[model samples]
Target chain A: MLTIDSLTKRYGRGAPAVDDVSFTCAPGTITGFLGPNGAGKSTTLRMLTGLTPPTSGSATVLGLRYPDLPNPGRVVGVMLDASAQHAGRTGRETLRLAASLVGVPAARADDMLERVGLAGAERRRVRGYSLGMRQRLGIATALLGDPLALVLDEPANGLDPEGIRWMRELLREFAAGGGTVLLSSHLLHEVEATVDRLVVIGAGRVVAQGALADLLAGSGVVVRATEPDRLAAALRAAGVTAAPTGDGALRVDADAETVGRAALAAGAVLTELRAADGGRLEDLFFSLTGAAGSGAPARTEVAA
Target chain B: MTATTVATTGDGTSRALPEVPRIPFSRIVSVELRKSLDTRAGTLLVAAAVLLTLAPVGWQLTHLTDGVPDFDLWVSSARGGVALFLPVIGILAMTSEWTQRTALTTFTLVSRRGRVLAAKLAAAVLVGVAVMAFVLAVAAAALLVASGLEGTTPVWGDVGSVVGGSLVASALNVTMGAAFGAAIAQSAAAITMFLVAPTLWQVVGTALLGDDAQWLDVFQAFARLSSFELAGHDAQVVTSVLAWVGLPLAFGWVRALRRNVS
Candidate 1:
């Protein structure tokens, strides 16, 4: 299992790259950590795996910090970047070297190479391999220790449809065997199909997080009223979260029926009341992350 | 705790789990050595060092009448070849992790970066020793052939001093190169800085302070080191070594430990 407790990373007194981000991924499931480019997904993963130290808070695997773990490679397989593989060594040599470091039999490396369908290409140098091939090799290296948990960053990038499907199946099989997988990706639909849980971030803060279905299914209602202020106040009084999604619409954290009842009670004329999720999870993803945008969030909103 | 020990689970509860073995220093050293040998660049460096070592022997064989065909001449020639290539090889070994973006994988596998660095240094020193051994073997063979020729004065000048000093001097060169590599991180920049910056300093220093500044010259000290005759240059050797090798090494160690592998 993996847990991130209010982890924050601020470089050189600038705004925190990852601001108070927290989430947990359980065994037997895949948690998709999603964000746009520069949304600090990689930074968060780096901190989680102990590459970059967090400014505050903690990220741990199996209730132990990565560095504190007796042998992290034996417990947590980490692939922060596919492109980070050495370009010099042949694919076979790469696996063999990692195997020796991991104290596993060299045969395991060959097995992994064959498992990743890189058997024929094992003799080729990594410099000649494509980006997708690097990802495969990286995955093979991560699995070399036969770890209980896997942390992959943008593992699906540069993969063909078949390769992605293979990876999805691989992750699925891993999770099915009581393995915990925390993967970060900006590929919405790809993750939407694979992940059991979602942790979406924008501007270094968690915009939304929950089980995949719960986050996408009627998360809240988008209500447009003649007096949005009155409706928002009523929703707030009812302990329902409400935020202006622009265009005179309030994104209310309640079902349509509950929202309708609250609006009627508030005596606010409702011209529009619909589920906030216009389509599938993409709409919710866009709505939640789009509002925060990228880079630094509005300071006034952060202060609030 | 035994190999089978209790570990805390993610749910804030303790459970029994098998303790896997730590990545041993020996394995890491082997890996570092392999990292230095497996690449094309690594192979070429060693091959070039060998060729350069042998090239002088061939030339000396043809131009035998010019000088006494002695062990000193052949040993010194091989030492030059090994010393010249040793630093380049060492720099590549240290900086390739950053240049190839492999530090992420390396550090992730073995979280304690100090161990990796220690392995790199150990591996580099071992490579230096091994290369020096090869150089000596070739030098001895060349000396034997040259001494066999008529009118050639057979001279093994201070075998202990030359062999011992050459080993120490070559190791220092490689280690210094690694320190520069570690401090700068980028391969090209680190190599350029290491190869050029000190020479420029020596030139300017000599121009300004005359021969008095030779005390601060690392290159001179290392050259004199091969003779193992520091009658009056002991302090100079120590001072130059401290200024050139020690400072950069300490700074590089800290940087290696603290810098985030991106």
Candidate 2:
């Protein structure tokens, strides 16, 4: 299990890059750290891996602080950025070096190369590899130690469709094998499908966090019917607010059963009547953050 | 598969997980060596060292009369390879981490930032020593063959001084390169500064200070560390060694340990 307590990091004395953030990830589960661009996701990952020190707060992996952990590479596997590679070394040599540093056997390096599907090109220098190939090589390096926990930032940034599927499967398998997986990604749909729990942050502070099911459960409901106006009126009378979703449909804050009963009671002709499942998680994310375009979420200071 | 069958183990017993061992230093060194030696630039540096050593020896053999040249001049010329080439190797080593974005992978594996830096320094020092040794061997062999043809033996003391000076100079150059590489974190800029700055200082110092230039130039201190006399003045080799070699290395170590990898 990984526990992050009141973690805070500030570039200056002003707003922090990561604020008073706290979360935990248990073994045998995939936890997603969700945020938009510049949402402090990268900074938090860096701090967690001990690459960058937090100005305040603390993070512990399996009951040991990062620095105090015995052979950290054996416990926590991290792939912070796929771009972190030397162009001069070959893919095979890259993993070999990591394996040596982490005390893993040289043979394990070849295994990781095959596992990441870079076997044929393992001898090729990293400079010649495409972005996606580099990312795979990065993941292969992370797995070299056969660590108990995995932390990755945007691991799926440049993968193809098939590669993405393989990555998802790999993550699931890693979690199933009793390893904790903490991954950050801007891809909401993928997160919704892959993560068992999620911690969403905006402006450097967590806006919401819980199981995926719970987050979707409280997203209100979307109601669509033939006589939208009548249904809206009925919902208002029933103490439930309804609004047009700008798609010629009304989204109501009532469950499917409640909306169904209301629509029928009001004799409204229904062409479409179903709960909106709260649209997509992406819409909900935007609603919570309220940050558009290049506007970063407000920064909050959290103590580690 | 019933709820009643699921019992909570409240006895507070914990099982220990299997331990993974730490990687050995020999493997670390080998891996670091492989990573560097496989590169084109690494190959180029090695070639440059060999060529630089041979060219001077060839010139002295083909042009000089039938007498052994000053052992000091011969050794000094051979040792000059470190001052000329090791910095490029150092720049490649340090900037390669950043340029290739391998810093993340490196730190992730070692975790302890300080250990990685130490390993890098160790690798660089080993390479520098090895290259200096190779140059010395080549220079000795050349002098032996040349003496066989000329019927004159080379002076041993001059050869010893040249070897000692080259060893120290190579160590200093490698450390300086590592320092510059860490501080700038860019291959092109760091290598350029290593090559350009000293020459620029020498030129500007000569132009501005004339006879008084000796006291003001930092490159003069480095040149003194080389024990290579220029113009008519003798350089304070000891002071040069302390300032150029000692300071840059200390600065690099501190910066590497403290700087954020991201």
Candidate 3:
């Protein structure tokens, strides 16, 4: 299990980059740490991996701080930056060095190179590698110790669609085998597809987090109508709070059935009304992050 | 620092897993040694050192104007060329982690940053010793040429101090370079400091303290490192070495160990 309690990091006198955040990532689950630019997702991951020290509070993997754990690489493998490998070394040499550092047999380097689909590029220097190749090499280095847990930051950043799909399956299999994973990414679709749970951060605070299904289910309905203002007022009259999405839509904290009946009683013409499916996670994300303005509704209309 | 005890799953169930033993220091050193030689920069730096050392040997043997050059002098001259450039190799080894931005990968693999740094230092020391040996071999070849030119047999009696002093001096230079590299953490910046800062300090000391500056000059102290027979300079040598090497190394070691990997 990964336990983070009130973890915070403040640079100089500025606001905390990661502020008083707390969450748990249990075994047998892939927790997607989602956030936008400057939302402190990287800071949090850095704290967890002992790359950056917290100003206050603590983050631990398996009940111990990263540095405190004996053989931390064997317990929690981390890939904070995919380009952090030495450019002068070959792909195989990079993994071989990692294996040696972790006390794994050198043969593990070849195995991981094949595993990450870089077998043919094993002898190439990282300086000549494409960004995607570097990501694969980074992943190979992470798995060199056959760690029990993984903490990856933007593991899908440089991957192509097929590579991303492969990574998702690989992480899923790792978790299914009783490993713990905390993956952070700004790509919403990637997180939605890969993670079992979601921990969303906005402005350095966790705005929402829980099992993916539960968070989506709790998001209620995304309703649209010709007279959005009137429909919103009627939902208010029905004791359901509706937040305007700045388009021809209102998001209510009630089921679609309840919203439909309220709209019917108010004599409002319904153009669209449904439990948000693909847009559900994105909707919940914007709402929690306080971005339910012009952007969310515009995106929803485009998707619709 | 050596081992972790979490053998069970996060759900409190123990699964059949392969046992991973703690990594020994020897393995870490071996990897560090391999890394020093594997990189282009490292390989080039060593190649350059060897070429530079041989250049001086070749010049002396071809010229042969000083009549059968003293074997000790011939070796010392060659060692001088090696010592001049060998420290750069050491600096590259120490600063490569930061220069390549591989500290995150390195520390993550070995959580004990101290051990990794220790391994790097050990690898550098090994390189230093090897460089000294290479210079000595070139000097031995130069001695044969000198003997051929002068029709005098080469004496092996003076080989000990020349070899011993050169090893100690070259190794010390490597360590000093590494200490500066660790403190600065950037290759260009550390190399600049290693090469220029001491010379600047020497000049400033001479201007400000006059004759008293000799007592604190790192170069003056290094000049006496191999020749303790100089007498009365022992204390100056210790103080100069401590000031130049020990202080920065201690500070850099702590910073490297504690600073955030990011």
Candidate 4:
């Protein structure tokens, strides 16, 4: 298990980049680190990997502080800043060098290259590799030691659709094999589809942390109906809230079955009746951070 | 029987998983050396050092035959070759990490930053020793050919000191280069400073201090250390070695260990 305890990092007394952020990711799970630009996702990852020292607090991997660990490369496979690679080295050579550093056999490099689907292009220099290819090479390098824990910062940044699919599957497979995986990404939709648990940060502090299901439990679903006034009345009677959407339809925050039944009971012709995908998760994110559209809702820290 | 067998097999398969081997430090150093050696620039630096050392010795062999055949002559000739080429080799070694972006891969594998620096320094010293040996061998061969023409015996003691001094000087130069690269953390700037700093120090010292200016020149100090000549002067050879080599290296180490890798 990876435990980050009260991790606080401040740059020159500026606002803490990562403030009192605490979370645990156990083996057999993929934890998605969600945050906006400049939200300290990268900084937090750097501190965890011991690339940068935290102003205060600590992160332990497998119950040992990063510096105290006997063999760090064997325990934690980190791929922070995917662009941190030599342009002159070939994809295969890069992994080979990394494996050698971690004291793994050279043959493992070829295996990892094939695993990341870069087998064909392993001989080609990294400078010639596309952004997606570089990302794959980075992943291969990370897996050279067959680490127990994986920490990736924006691993999906430059990936195409097919590459993203492969990455999602790869991460899931890694997690399934009883390894801890913590990935940070700006793609909320992808995170929603891939991760089981999430730690969402905003303006440097973790605003939400739990299983995706638990966080979305009280976050009511959106229901759209044609007969606006009648649907609103029915939703109120069913102890649900409804607001008129831009398209002149009542958007009710209730389950689809209840809203459909209420529309049927009200004898209102339902042109469209469906629950939206929990208000786009992004909207919930904005609302949680008080960073919604102009004149955002008054800042209220949501108690997790 | 088939149903019972399948149930038992499924239950047994879920018992446990085998362990994976852990990587060791020796492998890390070996890999670092391999990657450093594979580069085109690395090959060129070694080739240049070899050629430069042999070319001058080869020319000297073809010409002069009047002086006594001595290892001091060979040592001096080899030192001349090293004085010209080793600094360039040193610059290449230090800047290659940054220019290639290999620093990222290097640091990631050996996350303890200090170890990575240590490994690079060790590799550089080994290379410096090898290059010095090559220069000495080539110079000896050239002198033997000259001695055959002149029918004279060669002095081995002077040859040994020359080779030893060249090796020590080359090692110091390489270490200085690594330290400079670490402190500056930029290839262009580090290379430029490595090339120009000593010359600038020499010129400034000569203009200001007159005959005693040698004491102020960094290059002169380094040369004095290599020649073991500092008794007559106020500054000790030990002090010169420490100032030129030790101070810069310590500063570089601090910068490398503390600076955030960009």
Candidate 5:
């Protein structure tokens, strides 16, 4: 388990980069750390890995601070930057060196290279490798010690679709084996597809966090009828929050059954009625953070 | 940090994952030594140093009309040429991490940043020793050739100072280069400062203190140290080392230990 308690990092008197943030990544779960660019995701990862000191609070891996952990590489694997590799060494040599540092046998280097699909390119210098290849090598380096927990920042940025699928499955298998994973990304769809839990941060603070299913099971319904505004007003009279989704649809904070009863009692003919999508994590993300383009769920738009 | 606690399976049998040992410092040093010579740039710099050492001896041989050069003279000349180029190899060892952006990977694996720096230093000192030995062998061969042409016995007098002085000079030069490399993490900036700072300081000191007080100049003081002549100016040599090597090394060590890898 990884516990981050009220962690904060401030750069020279400027506002905090990561401010009073706290969360836990339980074992056997893939937690997606979602945020926009400069959202303190990398800074937090850096602090956790002991690459940068935290201004206040602490981040511990397996109940111990990163630097204090014995053989930390075997306990917590981190890949903050995939391209942060020595360009002079061959791909195979890089893995071998990492294996040596982590106290793993040299044979693991060849095994990891083939596993990451870099077997043929093992003799090539890293300077000659493409971005996607470098990402694969970075993954290989992180897994060199078979760590119990992994922390990666934007590991899928340079991967192709097939590579991304492979990575998704790899992390899934890792978590299945009781390993903890905290993957940070700005790519909403990829995180949505891979994570069992979500921690959405914005402007250095967490705006929302919970299990994927629990967070997505929204208590709302989408209603469409002959007169949208009239139906919306009737739902408001019934102590239900109703707003237009800008696609000729009304999103009401009431179950579909209650919404149907409200429309019927108000004598409003309904053309369409359905439960609000519990999978609109993106919309929920933007709404919670007040990000640009979130524009309160009041505008009419096509329902997904 | 492992536990002996066992987990029960579905059939109530207990199993545990085997524990692995942590890596030793010797392994870190070996990896660093390998890395020092693994780079294309490092290999080329070493080859260039060797060729440069040979070029001077070749010139000395062709120009040997004055009763053949002394064996000591040949050794000193060869050491001079190798010394000029070997510092770059040492500087590359320290600055390569920042230039190639590998500090992240290196530090993440090791975690204790000081250990990595220590390994790099050890690697550089070994390179200096190896290069000094190679230069000594080639210089000795040239000395033998010159003595044979003149039909005179090879003079072994002063051989101890010649060998000892040259090794010390080469080691100091490489260490200074590493200090500069650490102080200025960028390769270009470190090399520029390493080559130009002492000369600029000498010029300023000469202008201020006049001809008689050249000993006050850092470059001159270092020359005295490299010469291995212990009869005079011991104080000046100490001061020069503090100014040139100690100060910059302190700056670099603090930065390396404190700076964020990103």
Candidate 6:
């Protein structure tokens, strides 16, 4: 398991990069640490792996702080940057060094290379590996320790669609074997497709977090009617949160019955109304974290 | 340091965690040694050190005296030919991590930041010592060949001080290189400052301060150390060595331990 408790980091006098963030990842589950760029996902992971010290609070793997563990590499496998491998060494040598560090046999490096589907490219210098190849090599490095927990940052950023699918299955298998996995990403749809749980953060603070199914099950109803503006106005008049999404639709922060009544009062003919699920979660996700745009959830955008 | 514990272990099978032995310091040093030579440039540097040694010995042999050049003379020539190149290897080993942005991977594998630095320094020193041994072996062979050709005995004068002094000198140069590497943390900038700053200071400081410049001229001190003639002015040599090697290492160590690796 991995635990981050009240972690915060400030640079000189600037605002905290990660502000009072707290979360936990249990074994047998994959947690998606979702955020936009500069949302402190990498910083958090860095502090968790003891690469960057937290200004306050603590992040621990298994049962101890990273450095305090007897051998951190053997306890938690961290791949903070896919491109962090040394450019001079071949793919196989990179894993060999890490294997030696963790007190594992050197032969395991070959096993991990084949496991990550980089068997044929093991002899290539990392300088020659493409970004996608590097990501696969990074994953192979992380798994070399045979640790119970894995922490990765932007592991899928450079992968092709097939590579992404391969990574998803790899993570799923790791979790099924009772390992804790924490993977961070900036893309919303990517996380929606891969994670069993979600911790959505914006502006360095978590806005929503729960089991994926539980969070989606309790989300607001999605409604599209003849009068998009009128229905939205009626929902607000009744003190229910609502906002327009990409298409001509209103995501109301209430159940279908309540939304139906509000629409009826507004004298709007409904074309579609139902509980939020799949794709609509994006609208709900945006609403919870406020408007998703070029920057920090610009002004929450709810008609209040 | 608050006490806390999660309800899981590293086995990944819901079983008790197995013992995870800490990586021995020797293993880290060995890995660092391999890392120093694994790169193309690194391999070339060692090869250059070897070739550079040969150039001086060959030059001395071609300009033959009555018999083979004395043992001490050949040691001086070999040491003189390769002093600058030895330190470049040291500087590259220390600076490569930051320049190539591999500190992230390195520190993650062994997070006791200080130990990794210690290992790099240790590996660097070992390389220096090994190179000194190689230089001595080449000098010996040259002396024997010269004596065999000239039909006279090779003079093995002042074997102890002459040979030991050169080994110590090479070690100092490489250590100084590593010191600069740690302080600057970039390959080109560190190499430039390490190779140029002392030479520049010697020219300028001597013109201004004359003999007093000896107190700060690292190259002059290295010359004295390599000649095994520090019978006097030991204080000046100590001061020069401290300014060159000690100051930079201290600064680099503190920064490395505190700086965040992003």
Cα RMSD for candidates in order: 5.5, 5.3, 4.9, 5.4, 4.9, 4.7
- Cα-based TM-score, every candidate: 0.86, 0.86, 0.88, 0.87, 0.89, 0.89
Itemize residue pairs with steric clashes in candidate 1: none
- The parts of candidate 5 lying over 4 Å away from their true place are A225-234, A260-275, A278-280, A287-304, B1-22, B61-64, B145-152, B210-228
In model 6, which runs have C-alpha deviations exceeding 4 angstroms? Answer: A223-252, A256-273, A278-281, A284-304, B1-18, B63-66, B226-229
Model 1 spans with C-alpha error above 4 angstroms = A220-281, A288-304, B1-17, B66-68, B149-154, B224-226
Error of 3 at B94 (Å): 2.3
Q: Which DockQ values do the candidates obtain, in the order shown?
A: 0.42, 0.38, 0.47, 0.31, 0.42, 0.42
The reply for model 2, stretches above 4 Å from the true place, is A267-271, A278-280, A288-304, B1-18, B21-29, B70-73, B151-160, B195-242
Task: Write one digit per residue (lDDT tens) for candidate 2, span A72-141.
Answer: 7777889998877877778987787777778768999999999999999998988899889988998898
Report the Cα interface RMSD of each model, rounded to 1 decimal.
Answer: 3.7, 5.1, 4.5, 6.7, 4.7, 5.2
lDDT of 4 at A268: 70
Q: Model 4, DockQ value?
A: 0.31
Score candidate 2 by lDDT.
Answer: 0.75
Model 1 docking grade = acceptable
| Chain A TM-score from candidate 3 | 0.85
Q: How far is candidate 3 from the true structure (C-alpha RMSD, Å)?
A: 4.9
List model 2 lDDT by residue over B161-201, tens digit each.
57776786777678778877766778888888777766676
TM-score result, candidate 2: 0.86
Per-residue CA lDDT of model 3 for A150-264, tens digit only, reads 8998999889999999999999988987788899988688778889888878777877778887766666778889988888889989999888777767877888889989989
Q: lDDT per residue, candidate 4, B77-182, as tens digits?
A: 7657566556555555556766666565566556677776677777767777777777778767766777777877765765545766777778877777766676
- Weakest 10 consecutive residues of candidate 5 chain A by summed lDDT: A295-304
Model 4, A85-136: lDDT tens digits are 7777788887877776776788989999999999999889888988888888
Chain A alone, TM-score per model: 0.78, 0.92, 0.85, 0.88, 0.89, 0.84
Q: In DockQ, how does model 1 score against the reference complex? A: 0.42
- Per-model CA lDDT versus the true structure: 0.83, 0.75, 0.81, 0.71, 0.80, 0.83
* Residue A222 lDDT (model 1): 83
Chain B TM, cand. 6: 0.89
